[model samples]
Target: MNARLQPFVLTIAAALLLLGALTYSARAADPEPAEAPRPALTVTVVQPQRMAIPMRIAANGNIAPWQEASVGTEANGLRLAEVRVNVGDSVKRGQVLATFAPETVLAEQAQIKASVAEAEAALAEAAANAQRARDLQTTGALSAQQINQYLTAERTAQARLEAQRAMARAQQLRLGQTRVVAPDNGIISARSATVGAVLPAGQELFRLIRQGRLEWRAEVPATDLGRVKPGQAVEVIGASGSRLAGKVRMVGPTVDVQTRNGLVYVDLASSDEARAGMFARGEIEIGSSQATTLPQSAVNLRDGFHYALRVGPDNKVSQLKLKVGRRLGDRIEVLDGLPADARVVASGGGFLGDGDLVRVVQAANAASAPTPAPAQAAAPAGR
Candidate 1:
């Protein structure tokens, strides 16, 4: 009985072992399962646009008086008796600014007046003598030569009297010259005259800014000088961040050879913030023109160049180089290098490279994504 059962068990055990081996060999022969493909990046896109933009030229310059009026003394070798105005004082035309010592002029005028009085007496006597000579000539009561001599003496006295009167008038003019008056309405920028200080004729006493007006002398590049025209509006920015409005008055006739720049004179509207000798930056509006533009977010800067991620029909992104111009607000002008109808990534372009697979997402859907709630705190165990 043991021999027969042992043979049957041995056969069953051998068949079980063979089945296990075959199962193991089949599992080892099968290939591994493939990995899943990565999901495409989702992004928002926008189209190029066209709009009008202002053309302007930026320049820097100093503010100065529109015209400087130099006031000088007319009375030579006279001591300045009084100065009525100082630096930064406003004066009107015909206003007295200074006065020279009038003592010497007054004394000379008195001497001339005495001489004039003496001449009047001499002319009266000459008139009587001339009448007598005329009477004698008709009667021939005296020789013709004697009568002629009397007439000639009378004429000489008359001439001397006339000369004395002219001297008196000149002396009067000298007295009037002692007072210095403002030539124009203006603000005094400098003063050199002082009380009791002797000054010669034609010596400057004060420098006035005519009409208190100022101008901005913008130094523009010679190449851009032609773009600046008279009557164009300009905005000047001061160092204190104040803005002053001005108009282009004129452009210099010649360009400076050393700096390659030209002067564009701009008349500044009167403002308290604007003053002479101030350095300011200005922008002059040349005109306006149409330009192709895009949102600033759509452009990306890479490797020191500007690029935009252009999407293809298959929703794939390609980096496109662009030439950019003036930028205003959130929009930038595309001067060239982009098609009008091309779609570009609205934002997050910096994260993308050329030829990247992307998923086009509606802007409304992306903006509507629910914000994640803050994590809740753990509760006490005993609660």
Candidate 2:
């Protein structure tokens, strides 16, 4: 009875061992290959474009009059009368500006007139005497010596009368100098002479600015002087960012030793808001050309080298090395490497590596409006 039970137990043990072996074999089937690592970023990209761009250099400066002058009296006398002009008044050339005391000049003029009259009478007398002396000498009615003496006396009298006439003419000229007249059309900037004030010769009585024309003198650093030139168009922005157009009239030939800068003069006319002596900021169009330009956001600098990711026809990304030109505003010029129609990653470009597989979506195809800069990990430095 014991031997038969032993056989049954052995069969059960074998069945259990076979079931365990089958379960282990099913679990040993090959596992699936590992998936590729995904890119850690999403980005927005734009195509490079060719457009007209104005290259400008910026500076700050002050406004001043182009032609400023101080007009003073030439004659020495008390101010007897002032004309209708005052400070800030516009005056025309040759307009009477002021008058010295007329009484003194009038008295001198009268004396000159009387002297002229006396001299004319003496000339008449001398002429008559000379004629008589000539007749006497020819007819022998008088001694030759006597006639000669009379002629000499008449010549002396004529000389005296001529001297008197010259003195009278000088007096008249001096009287004309008493009235001050404007030398040019200008606006009066100052007035120091009153109606009753006495001014000496060469005393400044007025200051004027001619024709209301003004200039902006911008102090440009010596390093930036190359960007300024005569006849270049410039724009001036005020403290409030108001803009006005002007042309450069002059560029100083020499740099100032103290400030290490040069002056650039921009001529300006009166505008509804522009005023002289106001602080202004100027931007000059130093140079310009048509070029392919892209926003700075589209460029990525790695390892001190510039690069851009170009999108292919199939919306795949490839690395593009670029040569860059001068920076203009928010955009940078693509001097090399990028074709005119190549699309570049505008934002989040730093996240991409060379030859990386990307599932790109059109920047405009996002269901949600393109969000402003979202937080992303820092980009790796390129080699």
Top candidate on TM-score is 1
TM-scores, each model vs. reference: 0.73, 0.66
Model 2: per-residue Cα lDDT at residue 115: 79
| Per-residue C-alpha lDDT of model 1 across residues 50-161, encoded as one tens digit per residue | 6666677889999999999999988889999988999999999999998888999999899989998988898888778878988888888888888887888788888988
Q: Write the per-residue lDDT of candidate 2 for residues 1-383, one digit (tens) a residue.
A: 69969999999999999999998888777566799677545566687766555666677899888898888877776564765589989899988888887778778779877877887787788778878989877788988888887788788878878888888787777777788888889888788877888777898878888887778888899998887789988878776677777899989899999999899999875764676778998777776568676777778888877889987665568889888875655566788899877767777777777666566557663222222221111111220
* Model 2 misplaced regions, further than 4 Å: 1-46, 141-145, 223-227, 295-383
Off by over 4 Å in 1: 1-47, 297-303, 307-321, 342-383
lDDT score of residue 159 within candidate 2: 87
Q: Scored by CA lDDT, what does every candidate get? A: 0.84, 0.76
lDDT of 1 at 205: 94
Weakest ten-residue segment in model 1 by summed lDDT: 373-382
